[model samples]
Target: MKITALETLRTDEFANVLWVRVHTDAGVIGLGETFYGAGAVEAHIHDTLAMRLLGRNPLHIEAIHREMLNLPMAQSSTGVEHRAASAIDIALWDVFGKICGQPVHQMLGGLCRDKQRIYNTCAGYRYVRSNNIKPVSNWNLEGNEGPYEDLVGFMTRADGVAESLLESGISAMKIWPFDPAAQENQGLYISAEQMKKAIEPFEKIRKAVGDRMEIMVEFHSLWNLPAAMQIARALEPYKPTWYEDPIRMNSPQALAEYAASTNVWVCASETLGTRYAYKEYLDRGAAHVVMADLCWTGGLTEGRKIAAMAETYHRPFAPHDCIGPVGFIAAIHASFSQPNTLIQESVRAFYTGWYNELVTTMPVIKDGYVYPMEGPGLGVELLPAVFERTDLTVRRSSL
Candidate 1:
């Protein structure tokens, strides 16, 4: 079926997530999502990518994907142009799955596992919704069930947080207690006292849950090489499942050095754009677990390739999903289909909070593992209520 229309729908309520709908002449519409920078992504899709997509066969996903990236700007950077293409690529894949009457994961390869293990990235209901990422004080505009409920626990009551997650059958949880300190020190260095304070959460988790829980330390790519090495060595005793984005993502050499120095597995960056960027890291053994945010690092198309690269290097893959629901579903498809996928990153806040508000369905989480989403084409949709929002912006370009 020929592609007929491309539409971008966005709502500012949840960190400005942008949704794309690819419509075909056969009356099938596929949904896709990308988080952050809704305005810029919308412009790139409608004003630039629209002409290349309309009237083409929606089933020719790779050709259309390459056609969009053919723009000189898209090849050079993973900025707005590639982000727009990533959303469209996901939509096209969704359309392909619908046309074939199968789920996206089945199309990706077939299920490698019945259920994928998941790790909760412990974030507050409003963590990613704000602009200032650190200080934790910026999140004070909202209050959770208690101080231990949200971002506060990572700083004060990490043991309680660990206990809470374990009660829910989630054995692994990720926290970023070090990020605030990294922000304060400009990622250049941290005082001995600050380093000790950052270790408190892992210490508490170890004390409270013992070896029953797996904690992943998320550095958020906020530290320099020297600082990251020091922090990694300090946390070695806690035996976290992994250390996430300890240093910046752009340089493979620095990340390799950091990874080599630590016994902890360095779960490399989601901030990297595509498979090419990841190939460099995998080639250099820069990470032990390869992390890909389908929303940020191209969609399932590139995420699958990254997973393959990780497999070639004998590294496990974990799909990052701290953003919105659709991208989370997309990640689920890739995670279940890839044999190398070790785990998937999820957010308790988003999955239980705003994610339910906008989407028609969510993944089935049982005893800390997620089963493949059923139905077809990512197996989820934006609820009509999202369109009814007064703050929503809708734009469409037709063939």
Candidate 2:
């Protein structure tokens, strides 16, 4: 069957727009999630990529992918081009999977493990409250006022939340001190006293949890190298499972320096896209852990390739999940099919009722591990009405 139509659907949820709903003529369609802040990708999807996709065989994913890359659609490669390529790639895979009557993971080489382990990120919301700081722009999930009440409000609620996540059988959680108040301090050289103060919440949690959970410190690329090193040194005693994006992701050499200096595992690459972008980091031994985002790092097609590349370096891969259900499921397919995958990032924000409107099947989280659907393709369907609640528009055009 040939491609019939390509669509770009935008949603108002998270104040974000994800490209969705690729259509083909053989009574099959595929869905994909484009990441946040890549509207140029959506424009390319309409103005450039659509021309190459129309009338092409959906099953020829690699050839279509190669053509898209070489098609001179853009003067440079950035998240926008990658996001456009990723959405189309994911849709093609979904179509191919439907045609083959198998899940995407099976098509990738079958399951490495029946279930994937997930680390919670929603737990990070409390760090803002406990520190008595106002939430910053983009830090609050809802984009509203103060996220939590106060330190006591945060502490009391945080315990119950952790207990609930633990009870749900989640083994690991990621907490970020990503308050807006903290953003101004980011990338600035912080004093040792400030670094110590920044780490107090993690120290307290480690003492309370006592090794029962893995805490991943996310700086959001806020600290300079020296400050990051100092903070890493201070938190070394607590034994965080990983330190995420301590320094900026702009240079492999900078990341390498931090990795070389810290005993804590350095994780990077959520901002990175495609194999070419990941190569420098791998060659330089820049990171101990590679965190690839399915939505941001070229979807499952490129994410799996990146995972393979990371495996050659003997590093663990944790597919990043920070968006909607489509991103989560696509990441799961990649993670399930890769043996070297360390953990998958997730949050209650998506899995709970809030995300239910976006898709039919909730990610199966049992006892800290996620299970890919035995169903076909991505195996999740979004109800048509859900889009109605979202102030999103879908338009498809061909060059």
Candidate 3:
């Protein structure tokens, strides 16, 4: 079916999310989403990508993905160009799955397993709610919100949070208590006091759950190599499951050095765009576990390729999902399709909270494992209410 129109939607309430809809001549519409820099991504979709996408075959996912990334600025980075292309690529895949009457994982070459394991990414209901994605400001710790105000829970009562997660059958949780300190010192150095304070959550979790709960530490790429190495050394005693983006992902050699120094697996980046960048890390033995945010890293098309490359290195793939519902669903499809996928990332807060308000369906996440989506395409759709919301902004480009 020929692509007829490209539509983008954003709401003031969810400032960092942009939803894309690909309409085809055959009357099937595919939904996709990308998170962060919503404005720029939206502009790119309508202003730039539409020219390459409109009137083309919606099922030509690879061709369109290449054409969209033809711009020099779109290469090897999760910037606006890639984010916009990613959304469209996901939408194109959705169209393909719908046309084939199969789920996206099947379209990607069928499932490798029945269910994929998951870990809770400890973020609050309103974390990163606004466009201000800086460390402290983006925390959005103003109110209690609900039971899973997990960002606060991890900071103040990590031991309790661990127990709560275990009660829900979630054995692993990701936390980033070091971000505030990193922002304060500009990632140059961390004082002994800062170091001790940052280790408190790990200490508490160990005290409460012992080895029952796996702890994943997220550094948000906010530390220098020396400081990151120091932090990794300090946490080696705690035996964290992995250290994510401990330092900037730009330097493969530097990241390799950091990985060599720590016994903890270094999960290198959701920030990277494609397999080319991941090849650098995998080639150097820098990343033990590979993580990619499907929405930002070129959707299912590039995401699956990255997963395969990681498999070649004997590294496990873990899809990131601290973003929107559609991206989360897409990640699940990628997770189940890849044979070497280790686990899927879930934000209990998002899936249980505002995510319900936006989407009509979500994957069955039970007992820390995400079951495969059964419906055709991504197996989810934007709720009718999202379109009817007062804060909604819709833009369209057509053939």
Candidate 4:
């Protein structure tokens, strides 16, 4: 079916999320979402991408994906251009799945497995709720919303948080206690005191759950290479499952050095855009586990390619989903479709909290494993309340 209109929606409440709806001539609409910098992504889709997308065949996903990347600015980075293109690409796939009367995972190549293991990203209810994307400011750690205020739990009572996750059958949890030190020192160096304090959570987790809970230490690309290596050396004793984005993703050689220095797997990044950038990391043996945020890394189209490339290097793919509901669903589809998908990244805070408020359906996440989603397309839709919300702002570009 021909793409008739491209509609984008954003709400003042969810400032960092932008939702795109691809309206087709056959009256089937496909939904896609991208997180962070909603304003810029929205502007790119309507002001720039609308010209390339309108009246085109929505099912010709590869052609449209290539046309979307034709701009010089859209090359190999998870910037605004990639984010906008990613949303549209996901929407196009959604259209294809709906037209074929199959789920997006089936459209990608069907399920490799019936379920995938998941790791809980320990973020609080209101984490990254504001426009500020920085560490301390973006945390939104003001109030105790409910039982799963995990960001606070991990910081103050990590032992308790680990026990809680274990109780829920979640064997893996990702935490970033070193971010404060990175923010304070501008990622240059960590003092002895800072190092001691940052190591507390790991100590607590080990004391509480021992090896039962797999710990993924997230550095959030905040530290310099030397400092990152220092931190990695210190945490080696704890036997963390992985070190995620310990340093910036720009230098493959530097990252390879960091990886060579440590025994723990180095999960490269969700910041990278496409397989072209991932190839650099794989070629250099920098990243042991490949991570991509489907929403920003060109959606499922590029996401599957990245997964395959990682597979070639004997690496495992883990899809990132600390974003919006639609993007999370898309990641699940990618996770199940790829044969070498190691695990899925999820936030207990987001999934159990605000995610349900915006989406009509979500994957059945039970006992730390996410079961395959049912129905056509991404198997989820924006809730009716989201459309009717008073804070919502909708924009459209029609043929």
Q: How well is each residue in 182-210 modelled by candidate 2, as lDDT tens digits?
A: 56665566655556556666656665666
- Model 3, range 164-266, lDDT digits (tens) per residue? 9999899999999999899999999999999999999999999999999999999999999999999999999999999999888899999999999989999
Candidate 2 vs. true structure, TM-score: 0.89
What's the TM-score of every candidate structure? 0.96, 0.89, 0.99, 0.99
Per-residue error at 312 for model 1, in Å? 0.9
Clashing pairs in 2: 116-370, 136-180, 169-367, 169-368, 187-222
Whichever of 1 and 4 has more lDDT, that candidate is: 4
Instruction: Please state the error at residue 83 of candidate 2 in Å.
Output: 0.6
**Candidate 4 lDDT, tens digit per residue, 1-399?**
689999999999999999999999999999999999999999999899998889999999999999998898889999999999899999989989998899999999999998899999999999999999998788999998889999999999999999999888899999999999999999999999999999999999999889999999999999999999999999999999999998889999999999999999999899998999999999999999999998988888899999998998899999998889899999999999999999999998888899999999878989999998888998889999998999999999999
Model 4 stretches with alpha carbons more than 4 Å out: none
- Colliding residue pairs in candidate 4: none
Cα RMSD to the true fold for all candidates: 1.7, 4.1, 0.8, 0.8
Clashes of each: 0, 5, 0, 0
Tell me how far candidate 4 lies from the true structure as C-alpha RMSD in angstroms: 0.8
Tens-digit lDDT string for candidate 1 (58-162): 999888877987777775345787778878988988998998899999999999999899988877777767544344554543667433344776678888988
Q: Give model 4's TM-score versus the native structure.
A: 0.99
